[model samples]
Target: MIQVEGLTKRYGERTAINKLTFHADKGEIVGFLGPNGAGKTTTMRILTGYMPPSEGKASVAGFDLLTQSLEVRKRVGYLPENVPLYPEMSVVQYLDFMAELRQVPNRNERVDEVMEVVHIADRAESFVSNLSKGLRQRVGLAQALLHKPEVLILDEPMEGLDPQQQIEVKRLLREVGAAQTVMLSTHILAHAQELCDRVIIINGGQIVAEDTPDRLSAQIAGGRRLQLEVDGDGDGLLAELRALPGLSSVRVVADGRFEIETAPGPDVRPLIASTVVGGGWKLLELRRERLSLEEIFIQLTREEAEAAAAAETGAPLAEGQAPGSDSAAG
Candidate 1:
């Protein structure tokens, strides 16, 4: 478990993180999302006791992050963006050394168990320099889990891997997260959508959006979209659909096909169907359109940036409202 309140960090006059607030419960996987230089790593460092926050308070696994740092450190497993490893040391030797550093009881048994858990048993004899990138990432993860810490903080766990390696790492994370608290920072929205039960989107050193994937999707919802294919009169169909009540926008794609968007909270499909059928137009297809994870992420972040800009210009804006972000439909 982790709790952070008004967590602020600064480098001289520049605030890398400003009054961030959130908490992750035990046995939950929470995704930390932001663009490059968004203070994600700074927050993680403060949480792991690697650095101190300039203001505010934090606790990890019931221990004060500042006052009880050692206890907090002992209960947290951290895998930084670049893993620290000895190139000449074999996998088993490296893990043994980490186990000793962690003061793990019965270091040998712990090393063996971590190797098995990370599926690096076969590479126990392989030197760190000899392993592939995927294997090296696995070794880094193994070291993080070597101490059996209560919480896992992984920074860009999927960054530099091929597709297959990404899948492997995702599976490993899902397995490890079953019983431990996981806080993962990533730029990939699809990864978060697939892996996290809840997501916290950060921008300009502030919390912009926080919710489940479905709920986030619903924020831009209620706009009825339809892909319609007909046997003839595509232009006429587009014009007719645009004129129909509740229909806002219409686009003709190919021969006798159109994409349509209805007004918020209105279902225009019945009108389109009845009109097409009554006018002797044969309807070949019809379906509602959906927004992708990337689209949703972009929309939310763009709004946050615009809102921050407006605040700096002395323009008053509603709290938690981002420019270009539609909070009306969903």
Candidate 2:
């Protein structure tokens, strides 16, 4: 388990993280989602005891991060964005060395156990430099688990791998996270959606959103989208649908299908169906469209950026204004 309250980090005049607050419960996988330069690495470093925060309080597994830094480090396993590895050492040898460094009991037995957990026992004798990028990543993970730490903090665990490798690593992470708490930092929205039980999105050194993927999607969607297939003149149906109250936008996907965007309100499905029937158009199919994690991520970050810009310019943001529109922040 981990807890951070008002955590702040700075590099001279620049604040890397600002008044950040969040927590991960025992055996939960929490994703730290952010774009480049969003201070994810800084936060992770502070949590792992690799660096000290300029202000605020944090605890890991009941130990205070500041006063009990050593105890905190002993319970956390960190795999940075770029894993540090020895090129000449074989996989088993490297793991053995890491186990010793961590003061793991029965170093040889621990090494074998971790190698098996990461599925690198097959390459136990291969030089780290000789292995593929994916294999090397596994080796890095093996080292992290060598001591059976209580929490795993991973930064971009799938950074340089191919699609297949990414999938493989995701599977491994799911298995490892079953019993241990995991705090993963990644810009890959899809992977975060797949792996995290809860997500904390950071932007401009601040937390913009925190919740489960489904809840976040529902919150950002605000409006509903519908796709309908009608048997009639496409242009005529498009015009009629556009005339409906609360409708925002309409697009024709093909000869018989139309995509409709609507504001959040009462059910419009009945209205849409009746309109089609009233116009003598045969309605074939109708369904609501679900927003993907990527769409939700983009919308939340854009809104936060616009709100921040508005604050800086002493302007009031208007409802329904686009993010970069002059009316929103000028």
Candidate 3:
């Protein structure tokens, strides 16, 4: 329900996002993953019709964002990272005001329904200034849902919530995703892992990766790793496993667990298990250990930085120098 192509935004000589191109399908929940200042907010603002891009085109819900911005806004619900709330207005007043702006029929009834949906009914009379961060977040959500838009663009929806509150909000988002296209923006990998059908990872204002989480794990990591443990001679098992064909390096991690790497291919767990058993060792654990989403994110960022450096300097980044790290002399 959203499409962007070569969407570039600039302020003077600094580019916020460059040639960003991606799409979110109807009824699909896509996570927008990026670190701070990585142009996530810039892309979101353009998509929500909050600002116009310096160049390129975008469409939301099949309406051109530039020419048909009003139509696009009517079909989109936006909940920014910092929600714009009228502190002087009560929750009910704020929502009622938003509903009227949307020209929603039965405005009061719809306002109450959305308040209840976001579990903020009891706070109807409470001033927005008096609500807790979590409550204010719910109030923001209620306003976004007041018009029942087809697309939902949420930035940091899980922020300012306790664990229990996070769970409740996640449930609500899942239910909403059942009928609406959701573009969730957050740097929290765990949240995206739990809530997104697909994740689009961005770094340096460009898309670094986009795919299902499991597929990304397989594609980016280049191989699957195994975390194995045996209640016996750690050195002997490590030595023996290293000798096995098709296996790569093995290193002992915390708690005496052995982390082994192998090229992406057939299962090797059965073979490892048999070797441990044959040596009279008790197998405690043997399981696939793919790269965590956070690690994957770091790797992508590093790659992007390396690519950019290569393009500019015709050389790889210096060893031990992290992406975006300062040089010795600045």
Clashes of each: 0, 0, 0
Q: How well does model 2 score by local distance difference test? A: 0.84
**Candidate ranking (TM-score, best to worst):** 2, 1, 3
Question: For candidate 1, lDDT tens digit of each residue in 1-330?
Answer: 899999999999999999999999888889998897888999999999999999999999999999999999999999988676899999999999988989999999989998887788999999999988778888999999988889999988888888888887888888878889999999998899888878888876777778776666655443545677788765566667767887878888888888787666545666788888777788777665556556767876777677666775432222332123222221
Tens-place lDDT per residue, model 3, 176-279, is 99899999888889888888999999887877788888666655554457778777556577788888876878888854478888654555667878887787
Alpha carbon lDDT of residue 305, candidate 2?
81
Question: In candidate 1, where is summed lDDT lowest over 10 consecutive residues?
Answer: 321-330
RMSD of each: 4.3, 5.7, 7.4
| lDDT, model 2, position 164 | 88
Query: What does candidate 2's lDDT look like per residue over 45-154, in tens digits?
Result: 99999999999999998899999999999999999878889999999889888888899999888888888888889999999899988888888888878888899999
The best candidate by TM-score is: 2
The positional error of residue 226 in candidate 2, measured at the CA in angstroms, is 2.1
Candidate 2 is scored at a TM of: 0.90
Error of 3 at 214 (Å): 2.1
Candidate 1 off by > 4 Å: 221-226, 229-235, 245-247, 262-286, 312-330
* Positional deviation of residue 63's Cα in model 2 after best superposition, in angstroms: 0.7
Q: Work out the TM-score per prediction.
A: 0.87, 0.90, 0.86
